[model samples]
Target: MHITMHDIYKSFGTNRVLTGVNFDLQEGEIHALMGENGAGKSTLMNILIGLHQRDQGTIMIDDKETYFESPKEAEQRGIAFIHQELNVWSDMTVLDNLFIGKERTSNFGLLNMKEMKALATEQFRKLSVSIPLNQEAGKCSVGEKQMIEIAKALMTDAKVIVMDEPTAALTEREIRKLFEVIASLKKDGVSIVYISHRMEEIFEICDRITVMRDGKTVDTKAIPETNFDDVVKKMVGREITDRYPERTSNLGEIVLEVKNTSKKGQFKDVSFSLRAGEILGFSGLMGSGRTEIMRTVFGIDSLDKGEIWVHGKKVSIRNPEDAVKAGIGFVTEDRKDEGLVLDFSIRDNMVLTNLHSFAPKGLIKDKKEQEFVDVLIKRLQIKTQSSATLVRSLSGGNQQKVVIAKWIGIGLSVLILDEPTRGVDVGAKREIYQLMNELTERGVAIIMVSSELPEVLGMSDRILVVHEGHISGELSKQEATQENIMTLATGGQ
Candidate 1:
């Protein structure tokens, strides 16, 4: 075995997150760790990478017992981790990001510029990525940034690598390139602990799969021996018979219309009409103006020139507050940055949108607020001990639920969801999709922006492919395919 974690136990304060977790990975194998949201997948990965120490456990690496005191120590011991949150300096160059902490120094403690640059260039070439060593990292696309994060792991000469949702922001082509890199690394005898929400990816690349549920190991099986349903059942402790609920609402008149919408350098000439009970999907690469258009529509970004019609009436939305007042709700792409207040309690985050409505003379009505939050928590099935728990303590999947629930409380007519299921697990994603269907059934119009092609195609009634700050093509549900979307999104229209 390349790595073995036995009887792992971890907790935060009085809450036990991971309990008696056991996992093993063989050399040259991609071991998959599957679990529901807040099932302790990330906690286990953090423990392995030395971000969080296990309360009790035995880790055997390379036939010897090992304990990592810090992330640096883990890297020194040939273990590297790429967290879901891309950790890279935006101001630094790609080369600098890869060799930031592991730079080669002389015996006198002097920096070795020539050797470092040479090594960085060699690694970039080997990875088949053409990145300027001196260019700022912020100028790169999300895929490029993700590639830089992956390359950074290689700098440590990592014998074992743990990637948590690495492909969340990557395009299909970029994901393919990453798979190729993983294959090369496997041939070089590196064991990979791959954690992803995509079932296709797990079956495609991983050799063995370990499923966890409620902080316990449910099963460990070979990839070919099990299917998606089996894995999902193991993770959620329930069978998901239906992934997306049926859409059974009659189409209504256009509720939101954006005509000739342009934000100058950001997005241009984006025109679309959304009707009641319609879920319009915006598909594109990371920098292809999908999120920019959503931000512009939500009034988070200034629109240089455009006209927005709400129910056939012209509306001027200068800010997010104005957008909210106009019966529009926006769920941003970066959940950690814009979605929820990590330090705030679930009840606080839930009622934040309508806090003023629940307040009298600037004093919050605790009874009224609690009533609504309690209903929402149960309705959404948010996995939390209490509504008073911090939003940060909840898993990524549950945090996304809180985001959706927040917008749902607004009684929105036009909902714009950007990467709604970006970090959400399968079961939670299904719940979200069902929730979208329920909203539309009640005549709510939705505009969804997603990088995952299957989701865009599966959930949207119509998909608009954006490329270079403009819409390249638009397709109905029957006409949309991954190939067609990618071709148009890459300017091959």
Candidate 2:
């Protein structure tokens, strides 16, 4: 089925989003919607799925003007939305979550468990997914949970599927599987509206691309007719002259060291060192214990056997507070749940890490807090109306800035970042890279764990490859290559 959205206009109170935006999808074709954070991509899709009402617009499905008052109505019309954040219940079994709210029932109104299980199994087989039907949703890995979400879409017999950042949390292998599923869906004549920030994936999987910027449609073109640089320019409305800034910081003595770190099944025999004014990168496939190592060092997880030394002093960090007191800051990979409190105001989150500084006299000095927040907001270029704005209201890029600002407020000698630019746009990424450069110039060491190979090679002075909970190999900036990194990451000689 062909779908068209014309002159879509939506607003929340005085904040206007999606001003006169247009989007279209062809039957059985994979169309990508590309944009920077807060560029109305989500708003436009929410309108299409009936999550929010468009102030002014027209939605044409199969050339028929249609209005849906709720998501259920849209679903009944064969439109399925696969959210970026999986919507499965953690406590429920995969089988139960698959047929939620639309279960088949007998004449007596009892759920047909046998039929539902069979259908769920068949859907998994169709997608080549290996998740067990009886396993609890929460117990499954992130990639497996994502597969289950796709199976849920199939259970609805959806004709048009809207996928939002489907591979954001997936590893290389899982991403390949997802692409295979998308190809299969296209072969079955199912249209897909894929939204993602990963440019390589778009070039590989999408037939067409639509770009949006600042609440307006920028341009749409066939994949073969355009390139990555051109699309980035359209998305940000400017030429990004440099993706990575020049490294000017001089390497100094070691600032932090982890020796023989072992965390049972999580990771084992991990060892690394960070020098002053150096950006040390940790690269590996997902679930290779990269994140676990960072968490253990930051005191979020206990170390079974290891030693942490800061500035040549052996420090025992039993918790985050201890880590912070040791002059270390960590920006977690899952920013929404761990880095910032979405319900809190920007000012509150900005000062969360260093609240003691603001309340030294046992009472928060509001004027002093405001001054600090304003300076950081300007420095970080976080887009928001005021410090009073809730963190949840900000876009993904701005929210990440808030998290970074929080850590920056607390004076630090070392910083740990995991997937720092996971869901942000290209422009924001450049800004972050510039910030990292500035920090290192000030003699602050940083340890970054990234899945993007180019990012690791571009920004890191030294790279450490982790495989199956161990430090597989180490390479200098001049020696590191994608092939070598992958070889080490996959347990090579």
**RMSD to true structure for each model, in Å:** 2.2, 2.2
TM-score of 1: 0.94
Per-residue lDDT tens digits for candidate 2, residues 1-493, read 8999999999888889879999999999999999988898978888998899999989999999987898899999999998765688889999888988888998899999899988988888777777888999877655567778878987888899999878776667668878988898899999999998888999999999999998999998999999989999999888887788888759999999999989998898888889999999999887789988998899998999989999999999999999999999999877766788999999999998888988998999889989999999898778777899999888777888888888885779999988888777888888899999888888899999887888899999999999999889999999999999989999995
lDDT of 1 by residue, 1-493 (tens): 3888999999899889989999999998999999988889999988887889999989898789987889888888788899876787888877778788777898889988888889888877777778788889977755677778887887778888999888987777778878998998999999999999999999999999999988899999999999999998889888998777666656799999999999877788889899999999999877778888888788888899999999999999999999999999998867776799999999988888888778868998889889999998998889898999999888877898898888876678999998889778998898899889989989999999888988998889988999989999999888999999999999997
lDDT measured at residue 102 in model 1 versus the true structure, 0 to 100: 77
User: Can you give the TM-score per candidate against the true fold?
Assistant: 0.94, 0.93
Candidate 1 residue 19 Cα shift, in angstroms, is: 1.9
Model 2 error, position 88 (Å): 3.7
Q: After superposition, how far is residue 486 of candidate 1 from its true place, in Å?
A: 2.1
